[model samples]
Target: MNKLAWVLVSISFVVGSSAHAQKEIPKAEGYDQCPLGYINTLGTKCVSPIYYEVEPTYGEACESGWMNIGAGYCKKKTILGIF
Candidate 1:
């Protein structure tokens, strides 16, 4: 009886956890499903490649170790240091 109860409890726990797992996201209206890390807002639009703000240089030259990206902005230059 003890073994049977434990088995049933374990089964219920597994099923319950699975049931609470995230469901498939529906496709955006008139578009395919959104890529990972992207989300569909308002059920009618899928925003991808989200936008971000970049700090402006305000007419100053790019700081050392940074490269000028034009338009008064600078972007950090990556150094691979690979031989």
Candidate 2:
């Protein structure tokens, strides 16, 4: 019957759309990278001469790690989705 066909069509539409619905990757809930030479610390950016000091602040989700942006500092939340 037309009613059955309509129900089937609706179900198919829902299932088809679900397949295309991509899930977003998880992201760190904190600041990434640093303010150039400055390193992120205690949820704040700071200046550091050594590279190691800045790596941890970016978290491990980054593709490689936070890079020295420009001016103050910045970090991309979803770099490459390694996780």
Cα lDDT of all candidates, in order? 0.46, 0.41
Model 2 ranges off by over 4 Å: 28-83
Clashing residue pairs for model 2: 35-72, 35-73, 38-46, 38-47, 39-46
- For candidate 2, write residues 1-79 as lDDT tens digits: 9999999998896576455322221122454544444544545345455332222334324234444344323343322
TM-score of each: 0.31, 0.30
Q: Model 2, residue 11: what's the lDDT?
A: 89
Pairs clashing within candidate 1: none
| Span of ten consecutive residues with least summed lDDT in model 2 | 20-29
- Candidate 2 scores a C-alpha RMSD against the true structure in Å of 14.3
The C-alpha stretches of model 1 lying farther than 4 A from their native spots are: 1-54, 81-83
Top candidate when judged by TM-score against the true structure: 1
The lDDT, on a scale of 0 to 1, for candidate 2 is: 0.41
- How much is the lDDT of residue 44 in candidate 1? 40
